[model samples]
Target: MLIGTPTEFGAALERRRRELSLTQDDVASAIGVNRRVIGELERGKGSVRIEIALAVAQAVGLDVDLSART
Candidate 1:
């Protein structure tokens, strides 16, 4: 899926986690974050730090591609 917005990216992360049988807590533990942060991420909270966001994405095996928005 094409992730165009934070909400869309959050949904994709949720789907990937589910597919991998990982709970929010599990992901948080792996990424050195609290479960609430994971919850916020799943809810598409825009205030999340980029470093944390990138770490979360990497933890879930997501490869982000940034390019011209067109």
Candidate 2:
């Protein structure tokens, strides 16, 4: 999906996690972050660090591809 904002990314992450049967804690443990962090990320908190967000995305089996706008 073409995620245009942090909110969009978070929604996608949440959906994928549910699809994979993973709890927020499960994703947090897998990425070595606090469960609260996962919660914040899922809520699309703009303050979330890019590295952590990317890590969470990977943990949930999401690949982020950046391309120039056409």
Candidate 3:
């Protein structure tokens, strides 16, 4: 899916997490982050690092494609 905003990314992440039956802590551990970070990501916190967010997506089996902005 094309993520146009942080909120969209967060919601998608949360939904994927639920579909996998994984918790915030589980994703955090998988991505080498803390639960709070996961919470923030789930809440659409725009400050989340791109690398970390990508890691979270990877951990949850989501493929991300970051295209160049025109």
Candidate 4:
């Protein structure tokens, strides 16, 4: 798995979202935001706040595991 910056994380998130057949608008509603928010995130914009990111993750059915990886 990749780590470090928004590119890796954002790419993974976008891929998963697409795999699930979800549009930016769908995810935005589930996460309580506008479609533009998801678009910005998919574009790998790191200006997003962590809380919003977490909400997006939740909306996408992705769990945030904070355990250290080996």
- CA-RMSD of model 3: 1.7
Models sorted by TM-score, best on top: 2, 1, 3, 4
lDDT of 4 by residue, 1-70 (tens): 6457786677777888998999988898887888888888877899987888778877787787777769
Candidate 3 clashing pairs?
Answer: none
| Candidate No. with top TM-score | 2
Q: Once superposed on the true structure, which residue ranges of model 4 sit more than 4 Å away at CA?
A: none
Give me the displacement of residue 55 in model 1, in angstroms.
Answer: 0.6
lDDT of 2 by residue, 27-70 (tens): 99998989999989889899999999999989988999999999
Predictions in order: lDDT: 0.90, 0.93, 0.94, 0.81
* Candidate 1 lDDT tens digits, 1-70: 6887788888999999999999999999999999999988888999989888889999999988888878
For candidate 3, give the lDDT. 0.94
Q: Least accurate stretch of 10 residues (summed lDDT) in model 4? A: 1-10
Flag regions of model 2 displaced more than 4 Å.
none
| Pick by TM-score: 2 or 4, better one | 2
Best candidate, lDDT? 3
Candidate 1's C-alpha runs over 4 A off are none
Ranking by lDDT: 3, 2, 1, 4
Task: State residue 32's C-alpha deviation in candidate 3, in Å.
Answer: 1.3
lDDT of 4 at 66: 79
Give the alpha carbon lDDT tens digit for every residue of 1-70 in model 3.
Answer: 7788899999999999999999999999987888999999999999999899999999999999868989
Which pairs in model 4 have colliding backbones?
A: none
